[model samples]
Target: MFDIKKITVLGAGAMGNGIAQVSAQAGYQVIMQDITEEALQRGMATIRKSLDKMASKGKIAPEKVEETLSRINTAVDLEEAAKDADLVIEAVPEILDLKIEIYKRLDVVCKPEAIFGSNTSTLPITVLGAATKRPQQVCGIHFMNPVPVMPGVELIKGRLTSDEVMEVAVNYVKSIGREACLAVDYAGFIVSRLLDVVQNEACKLVMEGNAPEEIDKAMKLCANWPIGPCALMDLVGLDIVEHGLGTLENDLGPEYKAAPLLRQMVRAGELGRKTGRGFYEYNK
Candidate 1:
């Protein structure tokens, strides 16, 4: 594996900032970039809150919070963020054209040896890799939500990804204190593929007159699940689950489509915790 000292994370939303936090906590110099100053500041704020929370809970030393934050810098310019980084992880939304555009821009700005990884759980790694001149260095590094707390990350090898790049990704995952599970380049990868299906079915059950709380309670009480599907959907954002299901449907089959209730919830702008409502309500 090549030595990876600097990592650039594109996007400053939930997934983006979380990936940046973990990378910075792992002692990497991280550039967290977004299109606007406000977004960068928000991402940084979220990182600080998460680190401080961990320290308060005794999961990490109090001094580690500042140490981690010190390694992370914020930038609004894509070129400025990725120009000198050894690895660039794109954590933007699950939009195909937008991600393609970023990869193309990174190709122009990043060094030739830099590895490009996408945190997209629903998109195919091969398609994203083919967008740039250096497909061999492109792969999928799908980090789960609440990145600082998640201990598993999906590592995908694109069609043209080099073995060396995969090795470097494995080592990087380990450095960040997460286990890597290798998966094929496919829509919805592993975790999202399985989780979204369950969430979609939960929506259908809700449509069939089932109470969200009851479904969640049964799943937790009888199914041995840490969190029920209904509650998990709320945490993940209903819109994100809808989009992921749509991606799966396009790639897999009609059966993978999101249920009608899920579509209605997203259309109503009740996108779970982010928007303050979904199957359940939260204080925004």
Candidate 2:
């Protein structure tokens, strides 16, 4: 078994920061890396705020907040972050070329025994694995949005991923108090495909003249959904939801095409909570 004591998380966005936080909380030394010092600082700030919130709610001890934070370090240098990593989880944007570039660099910088994981929701893990020399050690560790709160994570196996790497991923997810659902290497895996279909349909409803608020309310009250699709899309960012739909359509079929409204909203830059608007408006 590969001992994963240190983890390097590339891309310090929401997903990256969340992964780093959970890994640190699970006792791993974590490095959260981004391309810029400003981004690194912002990601660290987000982690601190999240930890403090948990402490305030009594979900975690106050002292544990600092302890967990202490286990995490920030880095702007990819080589510096990857050099000693036992595991590297790339949570960067959903761009194939960009992810491949990172993997190529990681293959050179990380130890030969290090495992590479991508947190991609829709991209094929096999394609990503092929970007590195250690294809057998490349797999997917797809954590849901709001990673610290989501109980389930999808563990995807690439075409060349070894059982040993998959087992290590499963154990790591378990260590972070998350259940691992093994998925085959495919576009959108499982959850994202299903959810994207629902979210895409919800967008169509709005295009057909249904009120976004009413549609959301009906789904929440009648269907017992924790959140309505329109609202969920907003929470996920209209741009991201649109991108996922596009990937699915390209890989799966036209049935997964993003709704016109979704593309329009994304183009308009109303990217949900982060931008103060999407299906609904948010206070910035």
Candidate 3:
């Protein structure tokens, strides 16, 4: 197993920042980087808020929160952030070309032995591996949203991912106080396959004349889900749901077309809580 001392996360968006927080909480020195200084500062602010929340909930002591916050370093240089990293987790945007570009750069800039992992929810792990020089060392390390509360992680082995890389990923996940589930690389994997269908169907129902609230209520009452499918979609972001459907269509069959209303909303740029509008508007 690789002895992970320093972790470099190559984005400072919601997921990237959360991953950095978890790694720092796990006692790993974390380098969180973004292309812009403004974005890096925003990510750091989010980290402070998250750490304060943990302290308030007694999940971590005040001193530990301070220490964890201190362990994270925000950087604007990708190469500097990844230079000595034991594991470099790419939490960049989900576009395939962009991910490939980042991996190509990281492959040239980072240590060859440093493990490379992606937090991609739908893209094939093997496709990502193809962008790297050390395909055997690349794997998927998908984490659920709100990383601190989510206890489970899916460790996906790509076609070229080796046993050594898989073991290192598993150990790294466990080191962060999360449970790791093994899955063969596939579109949607386990949770996304099921949730994608549910979210898409909910959108279809809405297009068929059902109100968003009513559809959500029906699902909550019938399926016993804590939140209705529309609400969950809003929480998860419409872009993510759209991407999941796109993956499903490519990998499974055409029956999984993204709902028209979902497409329209995304086209209008109403991308869930981040945008202050989706199925519901979120106030910051």
* Candidate 2 structure quality by residue, lDDT tens digits, 118-147: 999899999899998899999999999798
What does candidate 1's lDDT look like per residue over 94-213, in tens digits? Answer: 899999999999999999899999999889999998899999999999998788888999999998999999999999999999999999887888888999999998999999999999
Off by over 4 Å in 2: none
Instruction: Give, for candidate 2, the lowest lDDT window spanning 10 residues.
Output: 234-243
Clashing pairs in 3: none
Separately for all candidates shown, the number of backbone clashes (residues 3 or more apart, or on different chains) is: 0, 0, 0
lDDT of 1 at 46: 96
Residues 1-284, candidate 3: write the lDDT tens digits: 56889999988998899999999999999999999999999999988998898899987899987899889998998889999998999999888899999889889998879999899988888988999889999999999888878999999999999999999999999999999999888887777888999899888888899998998888789878888988888888899899889988998799889989999999999888879999887895
**Model 3 misplaced stretches (Cα beyond 4 Å):** 268-270, 274-277, 280-284
Report residue 206 deviation for candidate 2 (angstroms): 2.2
Q: Candidate 3: what lDDT?
A: 0.90
Task: Record all residue pairs in model 2 with backbone atoms less than 3 Å apart, i.e. clashing.
Answer: none
